[model samples]
Target: MISRRLRETAVAGPFLSVKGLVFGLFILVPFVYTFILTFQRGSLLTGMRWGGLSNYRTVVTDTLFRDALKNTLLFMLVCTPVTLVVSAAVGLLLSSSLRGMAVHRALIYLPSLLSVVATGLIWKVLLDPEQGPLHLLMLRGFGLDVPWLTNGTVAIVLLAFITAWSTCGFYGLVFMAAFNGIDTELLEAARIDGAGPWQVLVQIKLPLIQPVAQVVLALLTINCVQVFDLVFVLTNGAPGTATYTAMWYVYQNAFNGGSVAYAATMSVMLLILTALISALFLARRTGADADA
Candidate 1:
């Protein structure tokens, strides 16, 4: 029996070791390399030299870094709330017994299925300043030539709008899934207690779905911080660094600007920001849980 058990254990050990090795090579090794490169001074090709706090200092003191951080934060602040609200609204609207709801939901969610590049291109054409359909319509109807992608503040707002519009339907589906899980009996009880639809949604239903909302907020925050493709395709961080996001800066430094070490450092700062946000969210949730 002991000999048989030893043979089985030996057979399993190799498989387990292989799995561990694969994970380490793919995940752990990359993470460690990034951390090391974050502190290196030389470019990607010239090889790394220990620069200690130099990279971090550059990231902290650079004016462009400040602008990128500010813009990124502002985008998050505006878009996160708008997406959550709009998605929740759509979810609530579709959760009813409306006719042809499936088709409507599909139409709304279809944009999210498209590639980011495709969405960006479509919007870029639609929002063209001079002759684009949207611009032409606005000019003809309202006599406003809104330079959606040319101006700094307006461009940032446009980015927020585009991001929210593209992704809200997907989030709506998320909220719908959570809404479906809710007990009908609770809603019925609320109605019996003279609670109207608005009251039920506000005072009862929304509270019940807090967990889903928390998850959505966390996910959106992370996505906002890592936003790159839309900024790249639409404005390319133009208008004097107005739409210059943290990730865009990282990308430029890493590839375009030949500042790999600085980019790595920026990436590390973004990672730290993400971790801090996650920590704050966890702490808030813990406090709420304790109160309950």
Candidate 2:
């Protein structure tokens, strides 16, 4: 027994060591360095000086940071619920036995396979007010010129819509898996109790899928809070900073504005927010499971 245990340990020890080393070098080291940098001020060209919490103070008081926070929160509030609902609907539809449903599911999921840069560029061209195909079609067909990128409110809405469009398919796939795992006996029991389709969906299906929904909500919340690539490629936070996100602000400060310390401070705040959201969702999930 001891000789066999020694052999098993020898086999597993090297792989575990490599995994720990890689994780430490990448995630743990960077996280610790960023946290340390939040207290220091300077760029590569300038010598660093300890600034205590001044970087955090500046980040909290900056108007641009506030705007970025507001936009990020707004995006989270609006997009997460909408994405959840749409994903659930799509998942239910795809899980049906209707003919050609597989093809429809594939088509819907195709957009998510595109790179974020490609997705943004494609939508940017399609939404051009003057010369794009969408605009031209609307102009000729309905005689209306829609200002998609030029208006602040409309631009934010478009960003949210595009984000949902690109991400819903992936979430739909997740939901479909959850839907598939549900017990068919429960659904049949609900149907036999004179429950209509809507009643079964609302009371039975949704309740059973709450755990998956919570996970999706937490993930979408983090994604929305950290949204940057689409905003960068699409609006560049234009229309007077209307669509600027927290991550975009972090990038601007760290790279363009030469405020790396402040950027690190903001990054910490975003991290805290994401952590809190995840914690809340997990707590709720745990409590619900215990009650059940």
> What overall lDDT goes with each candidate model?
0.89, 0.89
Per-residue lDDT of 31 in model 1? 83
Q: How well does candidate 1 match the true structure, expressed as C-alpha RMSD? A: 2.5
TM-score of model 1 (CA atoms): 0.92
- Backbone clashes in model 2, listed as residue pairs: none
Going through the candidates in the order shown, the clash numbers are: 0, 0
Give candidate 2's error at residue 271 in angstroms: 0.4
How big is the positional error of residue 85 in model 1, measured in Å on the Cα after superposition? 0.3
Quote the lDDT for 156 in model 1. Answer: 86
